[model samples]
Every structure is written in C-alpha cells, then in structure tokens.
Target: MNRWKKEFSFILALLIVALLTACGSNGEETNNEQASAETEASEELTIAQINWAENIAVTNMWKVILEDKGYDVTLSLLDMGVTMEALETSELDVSLEIWLPVQDANYLETYEDTINFSESTWFDNAKVGLVVPTYLEDVNSVEDLNEHAELFDGNIVGFDSGAGTMEVTEQLIEDYNLDFELQPSSEPAMLTAIGQAIENEEPIVSPLWSPHSVFSNYDLKFLDDPQNTFGGVEKIHHATRLDFADDYPQISEWFNNWKMDDEEIGELIDYVESAEDPLDGAEKWIDENEELIGEWVK
Candidate 1:
C-alpha cells in the first residue's frame, strides 16, 4: 500500500508539469499573433495629395521614405475641399502641404475639431501677392498695380478661381478700390503668361506664391500688401487625421520633427521639375540629404 501511494503521487506530478508546458506554448502563440496583427495595421498609410507642385514633391518624398521603411502608402489626388472632408471622416491619413495664416484658414476652421496640425514647419517664408518682373521697377506694391492696370491690360492674372489667393485678391480689389479684373486661369497658364511677359519686357502682374519654381526661373517681385490682404510670410505645415498619433505614433513623431527651409524646398522643387520621373528626383534628393532625412524620420 505504501509503494502504490508513492507511485500515484509521482504520476500526478508528471501530469501537472505537462499541463503547464502546454499552457506556456499556447500563450506564446497568442502573443505572437497579436504582435503580427498590430504590425500589419501600422504598415498601411493613406495620404491626401493636392495638385500643387510643392505638395506633389513633399508627398512623393514621404511616400518613398515610408515605403522604404516597409509601409504601404497610397496617395489620393483631391482638391483642398475634398481633402479636408476626407480627413474629417478619417478616410485620409495625412497631408503634408497645409499653408497657414491665410491660405487654409477656412478649411482649417471647418475641420479644426477633427484634425491634428503638426508642431513643426515643413517649409517657411511662403508668400502670396501680385507678382511682376523685376524690370517693372515702378510697380512696387499692390497699390501700384491699381495705378498700372492699363499696363497689365486691366487684368491681374490669377490662379484657380477657387484658390485662396483669388479670394484675397477680391478683398484686395475691394479694399484698394482697384479697377483691375482678376483673370481666372490654371497655375501653368499664369506661369506661362508671366514667362511671355518677361520675354517681351511687357508689364504683367499675377497672383503668385513663393517657394515656386517660377520664382527661381524668373526674376520677379511680390507686390507689398501693406493692407495685409494676402497675409505675410506664411509657413507650410503638416496635417493628419485626429487619430493619427494614436494609430501611427512613429510617423506622427517624424512629422512633428520635420522642418525644411525655403532654399531646401526650392531645390527639391527644381530637382522634381527637372527629373523625367519625380520619384527619381525624390530618391536623389533623399540620398543626397540623408542627414536631414534622418533627422526628420528619427
């Protein structure tokens, strides 16, 4: 009887050890599955892309960088209004081209409660105004455009009719009591008109923005808006969906630390415009500016 009791106790101990081992294995498998699911969720990112040159450049740059880091990024081309709406609905994950102080006020206000603005500026010294060739020395300010409407044929070349600059130009016209008409056209058309005017030494004024390739290509000047109708020296910013930080903390951190000066953005614009494929240019820029890129991503 003593021998039988001792054998029963030994068998019970073995059974307990086997059960503990099985539980440990199952727990590890569950933990691994959870980790894998989280990683997969973090790998996908959706970005709202505007048609502007600078937006294209920056968005493409980020797309390339993020993909290199094992992300699946999608760029959705949409107008500012649509982009803001999508962001508000959580359909869009990011936008890297939010111009502040004047250009995006209405949209910002509309979606203020639903979006997150980054803490840092991606590019600075952005400006918008009536621009003229430097040779037109007499046309020094927005007021001067009023006096020389005839030189521009009573027309101020303007960008998209829906653009914020156009809205401000209307305000400027009302404030200054100018008689010039705002000729609505595409950005490329406006640039073409400027180039033609410059070639012929004809006086031409257009609603133009800085950090543009045209600024580097042509010697032009932004008319002083003493009335502050156009807003002065705006900063380009980043905007993300409300849950971006909680969902993709790593990317949110990178965007918060991102900063690029006027020169760097202009160089990027130039490289992108010159390259046959814009992504090729972005890749080159990334390789050349690895230190700065590291700072942004780190």
Candidate 2:
C-alpha cells in the first residue's frame, strides 16, 4: 500500500477506537444513573407504634437519629394487632415497640419472617402487672385483690380498650373471676383517675407500665401477678419490617446498636409527658441525652 493510503487507514483505526471508548463510557454512566435512581426511589421509610408512653418514647428516639441521617421517616400509629399485621404486610416499615414474653407469642411464632426483630436493644425495664399506690400495703398480689375487691371499689382503671396491657389486664380479671370491673378510658383520662386517686391516697388499681413519668412521680407498687399474665419482667424489643435492614442498613445498624439505660429512657419519657405538649417527648429525651446518644449514633 502507498504511504498516503496507510496513513488514512491508521487515522480511521484511531477514530473507531475513540468512538467505541466513548460509547462504552456513556453506557456505563447510564447504567449507574438507573441504579442510583432505583436507590433513591427506595429511600423513604415508614414506622409504626402503639399509643403508650414507652412505645412512643423508644420509637421517636430512633426517629430523631434517623432524621438526623437525612432519612424521610413516616410514623404510623397502630394498636398491637394492627401494628403486627401492617408490619407483616410491609404496610408498615417498623414497629419500635415489641413487649416480649408478653408480646403476642402467636404473631411472633407465625409472622417471624415479615420483619426483623432486633435482639441487641432488648432490655427488661417495663412491668404490666396490677399496680396501686404505695399507701395500700394491703394489696400486694393479684390473689390479695380477691379479698379486697370491695376496698378497691371493685374497679380497675385500664387504658384504651385495644392496648395489649389492657387485654392482659382483662384476662387477669376473667381468670381470677374477680368481682372488680376494669374501666377502660383514654390515656389522659386514665392518668387523671390515677393521679386524682393518688393525690387523695385512695385505693386504686390500674394496668400500668414503666419508662413512665407517672411511675417515677408516684409511690406505686406492682401487685404480684401469680398468674404471670403480664410477664413479670417486661422486655423492650425493637421491631422493623423485613425491608428495613436492606433499605436502611446504616440506620438499622444504629438501631441494633442503640440503647437507653432505664434512667436515660425514663428521663426522656418524663420530658415529653410532663411538658406543655403531651407528646413530642422523644425529641426532648434525645436532646437531653446527646452525650450518651452520640456513642450509639457514631
């Protein structure tokens, strides 16, 4: 071949190679863009919790940490059964409040796959037995109540009708065949009845739990549940939907590592419950315990 023809062939070969390289890079860039779009589409998370102090306390505590991480979290309020069903169906992303041993054993046994139940943050600081003001030393056990039903005005003050503790309390009453009646009321009303009774040193029985400021403020004692209907040592279990770990691995890791000692959580519960706002307690708790919380966040 002539020199001119050879030079033209060499230039054509270089141009073809550069064109192929550019095409390959553009294809890779498109693929990357699609992958990133898929990831962004899955970023938002949903979490659910029942209407109670501890459930409210722990769920929102994690919420603050997650929001700080630039995540979009949606909170859904649900009853225990509803929360379980929602989490199982993936309608709910997580249920931060799982009370153990006493938590619906049937649900845990059945829907174990639909969600991830964190074991690390589990701690036993809540009790769901019958409770009364310390002024009533005569009532210390469930069995003891059989004899003093009249003294209690034959009434048991319970929280919202659907609450797990309330259900257990109802079962306790039925099993014991106590003449006492469990009067279901809204949380605020229940507290008002309890606070009023306490103020007067009147005898009262109510379905109660811990990390509650009321427990801290009142000199209350839990009556021995011989039946153990309300699991003697209530444990806090962090629950999340199956996608939680896959979608928000970092936040899930932090949740698994996150924990609040009894005092830390209790104080947080106090801030929210006691403030002008009946809710929004978790934010206050997070703000107050930033030092210890930083340990978990990092």
Candidate 3:
C-alpha cells in the first residue's frame, strides 16, 4: 500500500508542474501585449508642404510648433498635383495649402472619403488678374485694354505656356475679342520685362496672382474683369489624411489651430521672393510678429 501511495503522489507532483508552466506562458503573453500597446503609443508623424510662399511659411510654422510639443515630425515633398494624391493614399499625413473651389475643387470632392479638411482656418485673400503698371489708367479694364493692344506691343505678357492661368487668359482673349497675342515665356522672363517697363514708365500687362507681394514691390494694379473670367477671390487651405486624426492628434490640432493674416503672409512672401530663402523668411516673420505668433497659438 505504501508503494501505491508513493506512485500517486509522484503523478500529482508532475501535474502541478505542468499547470504552473502553462500559467507562466500565459503571463508572458499578457506582458507582451502591454509592451506592444506602449510601442504603438509612441509613433511619429509626417507632414507635406508645397513649394509656394504661403505654404512654406505656414508649414514651417506648424513644424516648429509641433516639434516644440514633442512630436517626431518629418517633412515630405509636394507638387500641385502630387500633394493631393499623397494625401488621398495616406502616404502623407497632412498638407496645409489646399485652395478650394478652383483647380483643386474637383480633387477635393473626389477624395472626400480619404481625407478631411477644415474650413474654419480657411483664408480668402487670393486674386488672379491681368495686371498692368499703376501708371496705366487707360487700361483699367479688360475692355479698356483693346484700344491699347498696340501700346502693349499687341502682346499680353504671360508666364509658362502650360499654366492654368494662361489657359484662362487664352479663353479671356477669345471671349473679349481682344487684339493681342498671349506672349508665353518663363516667369523670370515675364518679370524681367515688367521690371524694365517699370523703370522706363512704359505700359506692361501680364497674368498675375496674389497673396504674392508683387503689388507691394512694384506699383501695380489688376485690370477689372467684368465678366469674372479668371474666377473669384478665395482662401488657400489644408487637407490631411483620415489617419491624421488617429496617428497624430496633437500635431493635427496644432496645424488646425495655426493661421496667418494676408499681410503677415505677404511680408514673408516678399522676404522669400527677394532672397529665395523661404524658411529663414518664415522664421524672421515669426520673430517680428511675436504677438501675432502667440495669437495664432491661442
């Protein structure tokens, strides 16, 4: 009977050892799960900003603010068309320069499912026009220009051949029955002609747009388009991926809260346009507008 009892106790001991081993394995898995949760909580964010003056300024402004708030922020490249595609695919987390109801409106509606853009911070200070030197009072409107096509050398100065504004200007040409050739050249060439004309106090007209500091730099005025062929004044804004809210809520909030005034952005644009150093211009504006910068935070 003692031998039988000894065997039974030995079997019981082996069973206890197996049960304890199973419990230890379950505990390890739980600990692993907790570690994984912590890891997911510590991810970084990426943002895309286009090459435009206002875009660079506001984007860098947000970048500075986000980095200050302990986000691991990264920047990516953006083109006019490529940026939207990136935002749609979630390859880019955020972009703060979506201009609405124009060239980008169709894309905005199409990609509504993939990204969300807030209109509260949207600014509406942009304008497009056929402009001339401030001294040209006679050429004050699209109709006014027909009498002076000979004065403007029978050619309407224009930037790159394939620019959308050029397309609009061409349409305006057909619509108005203006007797002028749309001179197509690079931006530098067009601006060079304007500079030379301004120095000579000669007549000059070209396709121009704003929040650009061109009006401030040189005495310039936009000719009135009674038919509104070039479109209307509107704000440039931001669109970010749907994942932006989930992955980087803090950064998203900072960007959503950030905005700059028309004048403030123009000063930054002038600085960059003069020297071609956009980031430094943005930083300089931030330094000069300490009060405004603080307000943007609030």
| Index of the highest-lDDT prediction | 1
Off by over 4 Å in 2: 1-42, 276-281
Root-mean-square deviation of every model: 4.1, 4.6, 7.5
Instruction: Give all TM-scores, in the order shown.
Output: 0.85, 0.80, 0.70
Q: Model 2 misses residue 194 by how many Å?
A: 0.5
- Against the true structure, candidate 1 has what lDDT? 0.83
Worst 10 residues of 1 by lDDT: 33-42
Whole-model lDDT per candidate: 0.83, 0.76, 0.73
TM-score of 2: 0.80
What's the number of clashes in each of the models?
0, 1, 2
Which pairs of residues collide in model 2?
A: 272-281
Ranking by TM-score: 1, 2, 3
Report the Cα lDDT for residue 157, model 1. 87
Candidate 1 deviant stretches above 4 angstroms: 1-42
21-138, model 1: which lDDT tens digit per residue? 9999999999997786469546788998776778778888888888888789999988777877788889899988877888877777777888887657877788878888999999
Off by over 4 Å in 3: 1-49, 72-78, 109-115, 153-155, 159-171, 177-190, 271-277
